[model samples]
Structure formats: structure tokens, C-alpha cells
Target: MLFVIHALDKPGALGARLAHYDAHKAFLSDTSALKVEIVMSGPLVADEASTMIGSLFVVEAADLATVERFNAADPFRAAGIWERIAITGFIRRQG
Candidate 1:
């Protein structure tokens, strides 16, 4: 089973994300069970000025419970950067 964790940052929570970025990266690097396939995270781009709204990532996990644990332990979660986190079971057909 593979799981995808989608996390959206709270409004005006860029600072929190940035603050925990290093720890988050470190945790990702250390985690062995979770395989990060595509990690493309940035601002939501809501205006001409392009203010950041949230983040997104595609990860592989053994099970939903494992993914939930991983998400719960994430530095972003600890730092209160995520307003909402959605986890979905994923099936890769092409890649």
C-alpha cells in the first residue's frame, strides 16, 4: 500500500514553514520507511505579488497508519504550519 500526504499551510504561515524547514528536511532525510517521490512545495500564487498560501508533496508509505504517524511527527506539524492535512491512498499507473 502507498499513501500520499497532502498538507496545506495556514494563511500567513510561511514564517512557520520556513522556521521548521531545516528540521523537516532533516527528518525526511532520516526517515527510512517513507519514500519521497515528488516534493514540489512553494507559495500558492494567489495574486500579482504572488503570496504563498500552502505546500504540497507526494510521498510513498507502507500504510495509512504509517503515513499518519509520519505526518504527525513532521516538523511542520509540530510548528503549526499546516492548517489542513489530507492523506490519500495512491496507485501509480504510469510511473
Candidate 2:
């Protein structure tokens, strides 16, 4: 199944987001044990398209539990970057 993870950054969280950006990328790079495969992901930008305000990800996993595990371990989650996060099952019909 596929899941969509939409996370909005906490106000004034850019600094923390930047500080842990590398670790976040590294964590996403490897999902062997978690059994999750990232289908698409990127930062959500602000008006100017230069300031990142959040992050979005569409991933494939065996079940919601697997995706939940993957999300729970993200470095961004630990750094308190996201103020709100919504994870939902996705039904992709078109690109």
C-alpha cells in the first residue's frame, strides 16, 4: 500500500530543520529494515519557493504500521521540526 505523509513545520522551526537536514536525508536514504520505499518526497516551500515550511512524502509499505515505524524514527520528528503531520493511505490512479 501507499501512504502520504504531509508534515508542516512548527513556527520558527526552520533553524532546527536546517540543523538536522542532513540526518533526515540520511535516514530517508535507507529503509531496509523498515520495509518502506519512498515513492516521492520533497520539502514544502513558502511563497518565494526558497523557504521550506514543511515536508511531504509518498511512500510504499506493507502496512500502516510499517509506515508509522518509518515516520516515528525520522530525525525531523526527533528535532521537533513538524508541528502537524497527517498520514493517510493513498490510492494513486495517475502520475
Candidate 3:
């Protein structure tokens, strides 16, 4: 199944996000290397161009639990930037 991982940053946590940005990108690259197909992923930005507020990614996994594990292992999560996170199974219906 495809799972969407939605994570919201805590207010004023952009510094941490910036600090851990490289690691987060590395994590996603590692997942891609491991064959956990990523459909799309990117940071959610605020009205201010440089202000990032969250992250969103759609990934293909065997099950929801697999996605949960991936989420738990995110560098952003480890860096304590995410104040709220949500994961849900997704089924794409059209192009």
C-alpha cells in the first residue's frame, strides 16, 4: 500500500530543521536505496519563503506498519522538529 506521512513542525523549530536537513535528505536517499519507493516528498513551507513548517511524503510500502517504522526513523523526528505527525494509507485513483 501507499502511505502518506504528514509531519508538522513545532513553532520555532525551523532552526533544528535546518540543522538536520542534510541528514533528513540522506535518510530519504537511504530509503530509496533500500527500495522503499518514494512517490513524492518535500518540506511544507510557510508564507515566508525560507520558513519551513512541515514535511509530506507519499511512499510505497508493504503495509502501514512499514511506513510507521520509516516515520519513526526520520532524522527530523530524531531531531525533535516534528511536533505533530500523521500517517495514513493512501490509494491513488487517477493521474
Candidate 4:
């Protein structure tokens, strides 16, 4: 099944997020089950187009457990960048 992992960074954790970004990207590149389609994250901009405050990723996994495992191993989690993580099963439809 495919899953979408939505993560919100802890308050004032931008430094942590930046510090772990390389590791996080490496993890994503090395993972087998996780296929990152779109990664959109940065500080939250006062305007809609400002910096990112969190991140959103579209991933594919076999099950919720797998997704959970992936989340647990993410560098953001290790660096305390994410305060909240929300995962949901996804169905993609092309019109």
C-alpha cells in the first residue's frame, strides 16, 4: 500500500532540521520500501510562499507498520525536528 507521511517540526527546531537534512536525504535514498514522490518542507512563511515550518512526503509502503518503522528511523525524528507525524493510506487517481 502507499502511504503519505506528514511531519511537523518542533517549535524553533529549524536548526535541528537543517542539521539532519543530509542524513534524512540519505536515509530516504537508501530505503527500499519508501518511495519519496514529493518532499515539501521548510520554515513556515508569514506569506504562503515563505520558509518551511514542516515537511510533507508521499511514500509507498507495504503496511502501516512499515511506514511507522520508516518514520521512526528518519533523521528528523532522531534530531528532534518533528513534533508530530501523521500517516495516512493513499490512493492516487489520475483523471
Candidate 5:
């Protein structure tokens, strides 16, 4: 199944996000243990396109539970960078 993870950072979490960026990249580079494939992912930037406000990921997994587990292990999540997160199953009708 495919899932979309939309995570919004806290009001002032830019610093934390930057701090854990390397770890996050490393984790994304290797998700074999989690058994999930990152189909697509990127930061959600502000209107000016210079400030990151959140993160968005499209991932393929066995189930929602697995996707949730994958998300739970993210460095950003552990560092309390996200203020809110929503994970939903996706149909993927088009590109």
C-alpha cells in the first residue's frame, strides 16, 4: 500500500530540523530494516520558498501500521520538530 505522510513543524522548529537533517537523510538512504520504500519526499517550504515549514513523503509499505512505525523512527520526530503529522493511505491515481 502507499501512504502519504504530511508533517508540520512546530512554530519554531527550523533549528531542530536543520540539526537532525543529516540523520534524517541517512535514515532515508537506508530503510531496509523498516521495509518501506520512499517513493517521494521533500520539505514543505513557505511562500517565499526559502523557509521550510514542514515535510511531505509518499511511501510504499505493507500497511498503515508499518508506515506509522517508519514515521515513528524518524529523527525529526524524535527531536520534536513536528508539531502535527497525518498519515493517510493513498490511491495514487496519477503522477
Candidate 6:
């Protein structure tokens, strides 16, 4: 199954995001993490601007539990950058 992860960072938390960016990237790019089969993943901007506010990811997993486990280990979570996160089953139809 596929899942969509949308995470919103806390207001005014850009500093934390920037501080842990490299680590977060490393975690997301790790072979173990990518085993879930990521289709697309990247930071979300505020409003067509360079300011990022969160992250979005489309990935394939066995179930929600598997995705949850992966999320629990993400460096971004460890850095406490995500204020709210939503995960749901996904059906992709376009690029």
C-alpha cells in the first residue's frame, strides 16, 4: 500500500528545521528508510516562496503501522520539528 505523510512544523520553528536539515536528509535518504519505496518527498513552502514550513512524502509500505514505525525514527521527529503530522493511505494517479 502507499501512504502520504504531510507534516507541519510549529510556527516560528524554521531555525530548528534548518539546524537539523542535513540529518533529516540523511535519515530520509538512508537505505533502510527508503526500503519503504518513496515516490516523492520534499519540503513544503509557505506560499510559492522560499520559506519552507513542513514536509510532504509519498511512500509505499505494507501498512500504516509500518509507516508509523518509519516516522518514529525520522531525524526530523527527533529534532522536534514537526508540530502536526497526518498520514493516510494514498492512490497516486499522476506524476
Best by TM-score: 5
How high is each candidate's TM-score? 0.76, 0.97, 0.90, 0.80, 0.98, 0.91
lDDT of 1 by residue, 4-64 (tens): 6667778889777777888888887766654444333334445665655565556666667
Better of 5 and 6 by TM-score: 5
CA lDDT, every prediction?
A: 0.69, 0.95, 0.88, 0.72, 0.96, 0.87
* Residue 67, model 1, lDDT: 69
Worst window of 10 by summed lDDT in candidate 5? 23-32
Sorted on TM-score, best first, the list reads 5, 2, 6, 3, 4, 1
Q: lDDT tens digits, residues 22-92, model 6?
A: 98887877636445777789999988778999999988888898888888888888888999999999887
Which should have the higher lDDT, number 2 or number 4?
2
> Measured by TM-score, how close is model 3 to the native structure?
0.90
Which residue pairs of candidate 5 clash? none
- Residue 66 lDDT in candidate 4: 78
**lDDT digits (tens) for residues 1-95 of candidate 3:** 88888999999998899999999998988785444788999989998766799999999989877787788888899889999999998889985
Tell me the tens digit of each residue's lDDT in model 5 across 36-95.
999999999999998999999999999999999999999999999999999999999899
The digit string of per-residue lDDT tens for model 2 on 1-95 reads 99999999999999999999999999988888899999999999999999999999999999999998999999999888999999999999999
Per-residue accuracy of model 4 over 24-58 as CA lDDT, tens digit each: 88877767655333333333443567556777776
The C-alpha stretches of model 4 lying farther than 4 A from their native spots are 33-48
lDDT of 3 at 82: 97
> Model 5, residue 16: what's the lDDT?
92
Q: In terms of lDDT, which candidate is strongest?
A: 5
TM-score of model 4 (CA atoms): 0.80
